[model samples]
Target chain A: MLNEKIICAGFGGQGVMLMGQLISYAGMLEGKEVSWLPSYGPEMRGGTANCSVMVSERPIGSPVISDDATTAIIMNLPSLDKFEVDVATGGNIIINSSLIERKTKRDDLKAYYVPANDIAVELGNARVANMIMLGAYLELTKVVSVESVMTALKKIFGESKAHLMKINEDALAKGSESIKAQ
Target chain B: MAKVLMKGNEAIGAAAIKAGCRYFFGYPITPQNELPEYMSREMPKVGGVFLQAESEIAAINMVYGAAGAGARVMTSSSSPGIALKQEGITYIAGAELPCVIVNIVRGGPGLGGIQPSQSDYNQVTRGGGNGDYKLLVYAPANLQEMVDLMQEAFDAADFYRNPVMMVGDGMIGQMMEPIEFKDSVSRFDLPEKDWATTGTKGQRKPNIINSLALDPAELEKHNHKLQKKYDAMKENEVRYETYNMENAEVVIVAYGTTSRIVRNAINDLKEQSINVGLIRPITLWPFPEKAFDEVPAACKSLLSVEMSMGQMVDDIKIASNGRWPVSFYGRVGGMIPTPEAVMGKVKELIGGEK
Candidate 1:
């Protein structure tokens, strides 16, 4: 019964594509149908980049996420402004409060503002900010397991970048705890 | 290898290597740029050669040269680059060389936007090349299909000794999906290259490859030869898939990413008890014309959905042959049509019940 249509958006350096890929890879490992499509072309370098991800028990259709998403993971101010409207009514939006600095404008959505950058700074790795936001998302939805995400992380990092996994795992836990504590 | 996540561009390279392709010549273009990057990185590891030609024209001519020497060679580019390669593409076809050409299409009648689009339908299927030539064109909707068809493309090219074009929009090049590279069956009994220009050991006739037939009747004979190969391909290599077609009132025809969006609409329409079926053409050149015959007699309308302003609709119309009233819905210039939008079209076609 786990069918989630999600959009993850942020500044290009904020690792939103990685966030989308991790979910798709984890869902694939769990034998769920998954697809990740990014906003490509001229804006990939410094512009706001976003990716749509679908993980479902049934076959996925149309990787483009225009509206009615089950979740929208927002990592920056512009991302929230753009994607907040895409979330389905009564769906969840995990906002990166450290950078976004505002609330979800939609009252129907259940918003969880995780201080992802601040949490990453505390966790001693700035790049894991996206993982913190992802962690907060997993805690709320539980669509895919944290362990599966870790396995997917290991695969993505491969042997060369294996050293970074520990910090990312810790960031995920802290981000998850932020939601669980509330 | 276990299934892993890969972008469409990278997976295409992987499949080519699996298919025993040894030479890749390409010029960089957005969306498909990653494919040449993958080939440059992976081709050498397999002891194959990868070249980034100075331009698309040079790249495709390089393909013609390598393919003439009996190597499974390929070249890739986006819309404008593919347009640049047209002259060389026609030469390869005229010379009857077997090679693979990939067009990861972007929007254009000119230098259009860089987004997902199917605007190059006419460009690839109709072909921009000169003379009587038809390249075997394949339009894969997803990454998995891209890989499978990419491998098959090589076999089909070598089988018929004709050029094969593998096409996908920008979305098919950029999207990430988990794909497994299975040992797909080759459709043709791949014959030996008795025609290749490999240097004879002074033991056989030295092969000379040229597209020129100066005499009018000689050129006509050559055209008939190429046309015969195309006719054989049309007879044997048409591929398509049908979904939810039983007793449906509206049958939508589409290909590639547009077909994926249409599937979503069909699923949603089922909940409202308004049945819609899909005929997804996997091969664009052959156009899967016979698929129209499968439409239920109860069908009220035939719809052609595309990411362009109605290019393939003509093919559908020709295929259906006035069996039912044909309609079209499209969004061009890199704009993609959503499922909600497609469903709205279906409602307009068959309103309020069944």
Candidate 2:
């Protein structure tokens, strides 16, 4: 069982939901039970959108979650404010420093403010910021193998955007390196 | 044999491709829009046709046209958009076309809200369009069911040469869960499509797919034929699930996402030694009345929960047949009642009644 609950939240168009999908896919590829549930509605575009990705060795009981989140990736200020309190003690938070500036407020949980956007920009695509965060989370939590993430990304985007795989892989490597330096 | 976690909408889209569903026509609607977006991208890869129809009506008509041509076709929409497709649905049923229609329902009597709701129960089960026909409606509660039922729906529709529907609320369509497909099931390998309007080149005859029968007697015969098909579907295709009902005093009857919420309520009640269970109907049309017979023998009362105001409750009442006192507790217009709220109702129903 993966035995973890991960949430990624941000504005609708920020690829927050897709990041959750990637993690969920990677988890599934690793032979774990997983679910990805998005906060869906008209609000998904502008107001707020978040996805809950749960991976366990056993069949998941509820696709919906109430607390018990062990990992969070907040791409916006509102996402951080909303989910920070819910992060389990000794959990981890990966914040996209380009979009969010808040310092970690909780001493119990470890927080990493990765410059995901700047890394994505340096990689020549701001849209890949979500991939950067995913890469950082993978290195920090080791929830899934970097190989699986790479395979899942290729499986999802290879046919559509042929060039994105290399650019995004670079962004992911950058994310992993930044975390390693810390 | 690798599993992939995908949203309900994306899974449905992928399953359709895996099932050899080559023609897809749909318009954009919140909650379920991702389905079309997904189809748009994946269809081409599988040599399938994906079209963003101008409107729900157009999309459904395209389904009717494609189905008439011996093609496995599908169209999806939300509640309000589904209402627009009702006219086409009736035509499809009257024509006895084999196609799949997906309704990722949202709250509605009118343009309601975009939140998840099961308000389309009556419209879907009873044939939302103007007719005395019934669609073989399959209701999926989770993402795995969503994929498996879609494949079954396509098969069922083709088996009986009737229009089948995979009906679910927005939550079931939008949520994601782990799923895997064993081998590709091609729609092209189905029993010969003898009833299609394929070009007649020295063939037996040109099949004319139309709902109009001018003679009243002829129309009556057609209606009777459709009724017989509906009856057969009701007998063989009705599906449901029962959990911990042997010694239950209260049975929660719910479907789609509401059933999951009720399961949570049942768990909470079980902790306090309250005997509660659930009967989740997987097919809305068949209505799984036989399950209720077992429920009445054990449970004294029932709680019908849904995202609509007493829609499925009516079906529960009919199924229960006044044998056990039945009560309704639900939310409407996309307002999902929390488990705590639902548990409150369960406690009241158990406590308020002697």
Candidate 3:
């Protein structure tokens, strides 16, 4: 029962890989089995990028989440266009409303839209948009606790970048609040 | 032990360090860059040498040199790079040197793609290098296995005074999983390396490590010695795993990353009451031919599933020796067969539905 397959996709610079890693690391912190696989190639910044992340109680069979993604976090229009159909039936689709003007076409799945970029910018740091989406994912799925995620963030940022931790925390809170408001 | 999440490449690097390997010579390749990258960052801290060789050929020769000097050395690469190291590997084996080599296999015939593939089975097991020598090959199924095998690989190489290989696909290099590193594992008490090319300053005798022998009889004698070592490995080093094979009607043979997928297929088939079993080979060189001997009486057929174009199937056929109807299901060119597809193949082989 403790299994979740998530696909986070966006432009290369949208921190999709980091978002996937954070989820995987948080799952590991909580003693859950996890895997993170990125679509690696010559692609870099501004290129189509995505990562597959799995948090499960049992060992994962495949890291490549081809089609059975339980949730898809689309951070841009192109990402949504590319991965919207990959969401499993009765799955969830969380979209970044700021860049993704279009809505989900599927009727069977629940969709939540948050202006992650706008919220990050309003919170005074645009780099934390991925954190916003991650926060929304945590609130919706509860695969890992928010406390575990914050601890993982502290481990990642560590001493050098510890000053930006508060903004990321704010971004996460704003994301969860946006989901609750709807 | 505290478990930490790590990529397979990073785990291999860490395990190598823990196994007392102080020399690493390799070039960067896709899906396995994290290995050398980790070494580059950590080797300096341990006062070890991590050199990025100019090419795979140079890297392997450097391994030959370091191993000849009695240092635990390793070099890693993917398919194309491994191909380039064959000559050096052959030379190292001929000289009876000890070293570890890793091949994080990608799709190949020649730079085919950067995706995970088990197509290197023949290349790694059938001696891509020119020799009658066999490298003790270990195929790990997961990140933790990769780490554990790395430690064992170093010991095996040193104990046997031969090169040992750890073969995995790109998926094993790229995926992240939880792994716990143990302090140490049991190792054989190997003989003193009086054959090593260490400096002979007022020593008993100077040693030379070379593969060349002009006289055919001398060369043949050396080959016989290597064959003896290989025979001993065959008798003792075979490792494999069997799952749900107690009373199964069909057996599936797989290894490394493919075995996990086959396990998934087996789980699904169990739901349908098909009773499919799996034999996963951990050591590819010894081939675990004995595992095939214990097939259940009710088992009617054997299916070999791999991410290659029916390569490992040949070994299964050889091991089964035509006792049972053996079939092959595979995907090549960087493509991986899903669990459902493998189940479909099992259904086809089993004549559909119990």
Candidate 4:
């Protein structure tokens, strides 16, 4: 793909912004042009928080993604409710089945559901749910390689948090594997 | 130089340091808070001064003092905060002091939402402060350009001995993108600050840096000198870019983030067999009037896209000089116009051209 516009959205504490940043950083690692823009407002934690991530062979134009999202990774019920229609025709939608009880009603695009929070809890860190969703998105799209994401994580966390790399890698593997089995 | 991903605000802060700017004074505001935060941490490490002033008024005066002392200085604020600094900016300009001011603009008529907006176009381009002064304004469209222009802003300030404004909106301040810093340091041959107020040291006559002149004739002379410099800047510093204008039927004029959206619109219009082009002004003050002269002869109409209520369209019309019909499309109050909307507007303007 020459370009991909993805919206990662959930409640504030779900690491929606971090997931977007990871995707952007991974795109940078692969020597592609990337942009990550987080929605900023008066909302605090547990409120609706989302970020727009764009990876392209050419430089990104607008960081604000009102619509025309090539992929939508929604982690909660509200996010799925909000952004399901924004997905472009024939685009892909990934839903976190652990928190979202409803399914996307659109028939034009592919939909994949992962119990991301449950999978992260299984990996002993529920905070990594966004990482799980990121892995699933990567597996489905192959926009950036998993190896690039790993390198990006190392750069992000650095030496002080090096010990947590294993669990993140495991979470990524489990998420990608679950999608493959489906 | 290695490319690293950085937020636009943080990259500008780092670029200022790279350009040898060691004195930063500013009051904090939303959407641009990261700039001051980055300067707070980085300035002290470089033996530089970073003061969080009591207010934007006090901050700009501090810049005046530092710049008068021959120090490369900078101050940044958002919309309302920048409004408070206008008086001081006018004073600095009158004194012919070199300083860099950054305005990461947010929506405004008053304390508008902290989201990005290009509504400050008129305020910055036409002197926001009182008097007949001009600030060399640069509007960068992306992170790399932001970094490059932040460095160039300091050079331009010193080269002209005037305040240079780097105008960007909230999206440019908040978005993260990869940027590569220039390998070589800036090499502009700036005039020596022999007239700087550095206590005189009893070796020569004491230098006085004041904008106040009791005699109107003297003030007029000073204003005329400033006007001459501004004319020279208009001739030498106008910057812009043209995209796909070779055989375009409609031309879109925009700058900063709005230009990016226009580029996307151009791409989509091309796919539909609509030959559209873009003229992106990089310098708001110099305004790039010459770019309109280069608009293809095949172009039938001109369209200006902005995040403001068509502030730049007037300039586009003036530049095009009625050679073609001019149209404008804009969204204000922190709302960003989408590519589809811009393309729709372009199609409307160039009816049946496809």
C-alpha lDDT of residue A133 in model 3: 93
Please give the clash total of every predicted structure, in order. 0, 4, 0, 0
Candidate 3 residue-wise lDDT at B242: 91
The residue-by-residue lDDT of candidate 1 on A30-115, one tens digit each, is 99999999888677566899999999998877888787899999988888888898988989999888987778889998888899
lDDT tens per residue, model 1, B1-354 = 679899999999999999999999999899798999999999999999999989899999999999999999999999988999999988999998999998888988787878878888888888798888998999988889888887789988998888999998899999999999998787678889998999999989989889999999999889888888889989999999999999888999999999999998999999988889999999998889888888999899999999898888889989999889999999998888989888888889887545
Better of 1 and 4 by DockQ: 1
Residue ranges of candidate 3 with Cα displaced over 4 Å: none
Which CAPRI level is candidate 4?
high
- The lowest-lDDT stretch of 10 consecutive residues in candidate 1 chain B is B345-354
Higher-scoring candidate on lDDT, 1 or 2:
1
Q: Which pairs clash in the backbone of model 3?
A: none
Better of 2 and 3 by DockQ: 3
Q: Is candidate 2 or 3 superior in lDDT?
A: 3
lDDT of 4 by residue, A129-170 (tens): 988998899899999999999998999899999999998888
- DockQ per candidate, 2 decimals: 0.88, 0.50, 0.69, 0.87
Ranking by DockQ, best first? 1, 4, 3, 2
Which residue runs of candidate 2 sit more than 4 Å off their true CA positions? A1-3, A12-15, A43-47, A66-70, A85-142, A145-182, B44-47, B183-192, B202-206, B296-298, B352-354
Evaluated on CA atoms against the true complex, candidate 2 attains a DockQ of 0.50
How high is the lDDT of residue B176 in model 2? 78
TM-score of chain A of each: 0.97, 0.94, 0.97, 0.97
| lDDT of the candidates, in the order given | 0.90, 0.84, 0.90, 0.91
